[model samples]
Target: MSKETRLREEIVTVGRSLHMRGLSPGSSGNISARLDDGWLLTPTNACLGELDPGDIAKLDWEGNHLAGKPASKEAFLHHAVYAGREDSGAIVHLHCTHSAAVSCLDCLDPHSALPPLTPYFVMRVGRLPLVPYHRPGDPRLGEAISGLVGKHSAVLLANHGPLVSGKTLEAAGYAIEELEETAKLFLLLRQQPVRLLDEEQIEELRQTFGAQW
Candidate 1:
């Protein structure tokens, strides 16, 4: 298969996986992958469970929609991150239950929302920051994400959900899942005494795993 064809099929496959896993439901998320010319994004208002590979939207680096369905309005947010982080080849934004629940809680440190609970969470998703709430598709949301994308590969949108970028689509998908599960753990263990990874431990993970600490 051609590169474009492979990417299209991969997008559909990942979308279906995410939907079936309950990470994204009811058209409440968007997925995109960087392309040679620009990128491919899930269509606006399209359910992840029902995406057609051929109907995924395509755009130039300039953000002009070139083919297939109309692109998600949050495509700009993906673009902003790609522009800032050359290593990011794919992005996944989802309003998963646990992560969104964490986003709604008060007094979260804007710098690092989820503490490093498990080694896998630290390895897969390093230092997730929190973005102030903005209405869905608000242009300012892109700006907010852009400001922090260079420093963080993942961020939780306050009162919204998590946005994660990775070197590949699978990496992005897995990272978001880790973030969601970690968020769930955080909530479950909030009242109990927990052992979080210390600074030295986090640094060790970063050095060993090459996480974007």
Candidate 2:
């Protein structure tokens, strides 16, 4: 199979996993992987649970459709991240339940959306900033994401959802999963007196595993 074919199949597999695990539902998430010439993105309004690999949209670096179904309206989200973060090979944007719930909360830190609760969250998701609200499919949201892309691989959109980028499609997949689970834990423990990973411990993780924090 060609590289593009492999990526399409992988995107389908990952999307299906997200849907099955309740991380993506309805037509609420979009995914994309970088290609040599462009990108392979899930089609607009397509259910992540039922993605057809052959119908995955292909687009150039400039976000123009090249083949397959029409690209997700959030194509510019992928475009912005890839342009800003050369290391990102895949992007996953989702309205998973817990992450979306966190987005709706009013008091989250704009610079760091989630507190460091788990070491894996710190390692996989790093620093997750929360982007300001924008209506679905709004192209202007890309500019906000791009502005927050310096060291962050993930961001939670206010009243929206989370967008994550990683070095590979699988990496992005894993990171988003971690984000979702961590978000869930954050909500569950929100009322309790929780001992978060302190700066010293977080520093150890950064020194030992290169955690993003």
Candidate 3:
């Protein structure tokens, strides 16, 4: 199969895996992968659980639709990240339950990293910044993401969900899964005295594993 065809199949596989675990519901998420000439994205309003490899959309870096199907309306967010991070090979944006719930809370620190609750959470997903609320498809959301994505591999969209980029689609998916689970843990422990990983430990993970923050 051609490289494009292989990417399509990979997207479908990952989408199915996420949907099966309820990370993506209805048509509420989009996945994209970088390509030589452009990038591939899930079609608009397409359910992650039922994506067809042939129906995935491809668009140039400038956001022009090249083939397949109508691109997701939030394609610009993916484009913005790609423009800033050359190492990001795939991105996954999802309205995951726990992460979206955390996004709605007013306690989030807009400028700081998400609380480092667990070792894997810190290792898989490094510093996660919160983007100020913007209407879906607003260019400003893309701008907010672009401003931070260079330094941070992930950002949580206020009142929406999490946008995560990785060196590969599988890596992106794993990071988001870790993020969502961490959000769940935070909610569960909000009333208790929570212990976070110290700065020293986080730095160790960064130096040891090349963790992004």
lDDT of each: 0.91, 0.91, 0.91
lDDT of 1 by residue, 17-58 (tens): 999999887987999998888899999999998999899999
Q: Worst ten-residue run, lDDT, model 2? A: 59-68
**CA error at residue 41 for candidate 3, angstroms:** 0.4
lDDT of 3 at 46: 95
- Write candidate 2's Cα lDDT for 62-96 as tens digits: 77888999988888988999999999999999999
Q: Write the per-residue lDDT of candidate 3 for residues 94-177, one digit (tens) a residue.
A: 999999999999987887536988889888888889999999989888887888988888999999999999999999999999
Residue 147 lDDT in candidate 2: 83
Q: Candidate 2 has which clashing residue pairs, if any?
A: none
State TM-scores per candidate. Answer: 0.97, 0.98, 0.97
Task: List the RMSD of every prediction in angstroms.
Answer: 0.9, 0.8, 1.0
- In terms of lDDT, the poorest run of 10 residues in model 1 is 204-213
Model 1 ranges with Cα > 4 A deviation? none
